[model samples]
Target: MPDRITLTGLRVFGRHGVFEHEKRDGQEFVVDIVAWLDLAPAAASDDLTQTLHYGELAQLAADIVGGEPYDLIESVAGRIADEVLKDSRLSAVEVTVHKPSAPIPLNFADVAVTVHRGRA
Candidate 1:
């Protein structure tokens, strides 16, 4: 949509995995969030008050994903998407969680989970 704001490459450390070792060891996670909302006021007046505070969103995302240990990244990602969409002003939200150091033997840059949710 025309009125969308995206925050990308947000990284955090958290414990999330199917295996106990990986869960206890913890890992680094990267988040990319996209929030869609009408920004007429913020666009016209250039005031931080009228738009979503990206810093606060990041903190919330990090707090949610990092604060809890889930067996699946999908769960983490989905929760983020729902949380972001909880804002009445936001019409849509997309959330991604990247796990850089997964337990897979083969080398890979990262493993990620992505989810999208909309306002009810």
Candidate 2:
């Protein structure tokens, strides 16, 4: 298995949901991401250039979650996966988008969508 860098519990406000109120009043979304890539180069040289900068990754996810409104969490997950895969060093990525304030009538803890993508 390739080495992985994980970022978890990234919270951002987004206007994403199927309801009109959800769009008008934004809510918090939590995102988690795992990027798989070769870490040997960075380990050997101790250079930041050889590996994925997780800070940038977090920012990228925050931008997507905060930028646009998607009715489905699946689309959000897919978009995040697509953007993270833009890094050539990453062979694969797994993204999970959490919606804690979904419009479910019943009491629920959270709702989330997870997507896994690999270079084609």
Candidate 3:
């Protein structure tokens, strides 16, 4: 079985929207990331090199979120998937982006986009 790792509920502020107002006024974005790999070595050796560092992953997410504005969450999600795939040990990854304070007219809790990618 492949060892699995997950990092969730990462919060960040960024500008992502279709409307001019939203782009002008940034919003809060929550990110969830899941990475799957063989973690047996890291678990046995107690070495960080043998496993994924979620801290770094979170930092990467922050960087992505803080980057220039995006027209859609789908684009952001796609970029995240591509970035995660950069790790050779990763077999698959899932990214979910949440926009809690979306500028919607009606009442809603939040909006989100989820994307998954596997090594080619």
- lDDT per prediction? 0.89, 0.96, 0.90
Off by over 4 Å in 1: none
Whose lDDT is greatest here?
2
lDDT of 1 by residue, 1-120 (tens): 749888889888899889998678898889999999999989899999999999999999999878889999999999898888888899899898988888889979878888989866
The most accurate candidate by TM-score is 2
Residue 2 lDDT (model 3): 78
lDDT of 3 at 26: 92
Order candidates by TM-score, high to low: 2, 3, 1
Output the lDDT of residue 5, model 2: 99
Better of 1 and 2 by TM-score: 2
Candidate 2 residue pairs in clash (backbone atoms < 3 Å)? none
Q: Residue 78 in model 3: shift from native, Å?
A: 1.1
Q: How far off is residue 92 in model 1, in Å?
A: 0.5
- Candidate 1 local Cα displacement, residue 26, angstroms: 0.5
Error of 2 at 33 (Å): 0.1
Better of 1 and 2 by lDDT: 2
lDDT of 2 by residue, 33-79 (tens): 99999999999999999999999999999999998999888999999
